[model samples]
Target: MKNNLRGKIREFLASEDGKVSVKAPLTLGVVTGGIFLAQAIIGPTSATACPCQHDWQCPNPPHICSVGTCIGG
Candidate 1:
């Protein structure tokens, strides 16, 4: 069993595709994709800023109040 494990490790280390140089890119891509997927799943509902003031308030709960008007921002 030990020899089999050692052989596998040696084969991984000696081969070009099994080496860290080749695997690092694939690992990085997988990690980056996972981060993006998590962000997409748990990201903020609105992608804009919601401004407010003391006197006036936004008509819409989440709509932004800019220049005394409500727009997407």
Candidate 2:
């Protein structure tokens, strides 16, 4: 019984064909990486001031938060 099991195991291991699938996620990865990189580069482009005092003082459109106050548009 042991010998038979060993042979079977050997045969299975030595099989010529098996399930080997290759997937291409390059496009997805590129798009995702691009979006993330863009966000990282341009996402924090707020116009607020460095040391803001009030809401109306910071930059407009994209309110940037500085050390202690909100920047204006």
Candidate 3:
């Protein structure tokens, strides 16, 4: 089992085909940018942000508050 795995690794490294993997920073940036873009495009729904004071006092319950806006159930 170990020898087979080692041979496969050596073969993979010897070949120029599979070594070109995505860069970590680029991948992370792309993912983060995608999330940010989605948020910007979709923005925040009332379900995500409800305007009010206090949890129960707020019109909606179990919602999170962002900059005085509540978001949740």
Candidate 4:
């Protein structure tokens, strides 16, 4: 069974149909690598401050916390 599979693999590898040109694999590898690189290099998700007390926690420094949200003082 293994030998038959091996023979078939050898036949496929020897055939021109199974042989892909260098550019296809290179382009695929480059695109795949770029996607992975982009994912890895992406920064942490920054959540916008909604409910605040101090001016720093508010979206704008001109606003102060009124009730829960920051509103213009």
Residue clash pairs of candidate 4: none
Q: Which candidate ranks first by lDDT, i.e. highest?
A: 4
What lDDT tens digits, residue by residue, belong to model 4 across residues 13-73?
A: 6677656754467679999999888867984334333566566565555766676776774
Which pairs clash in the backbone of model 3? Answer: 48-71, 50-70, 64-71
The lDDT values for all models are 0.68, 0.62, 0.66, 0.69
**Model 2 clashes, total count:** 9
| lDDT by residue (tens digit), candidate 3, 1-73 | 9999999988876566544543455578899999999999987665425455656544455664556765676
Q: Give per-residue lDDT, candidate 4, residue 3.
A: 100
Which scores better on lDDT, 3 or 4? Answer: 4
How many clashes does each candidate structure show, in the order listed?
A: 0, 9, 3, 0
Question: If scored against the real structure, what TM-score would every candidate get?
Answer: 0.39, 0.29, 0.39, 0.32
Residue 1, candidate 2: C-alpha displacement in angstroms: 44
- lDDT tens per residue, model 2, 16-43: 4311211235556788999999988886
CA deviation > 4 Å runs, candidate 1: 1-17, 45-73
* Residue 13, candidate 4: alpha-carbon lDDT: 66
lDDT of 2 at 1: 100
Q: In model 1, which range of ten residues has the least summed lDDT?
A: 47-56
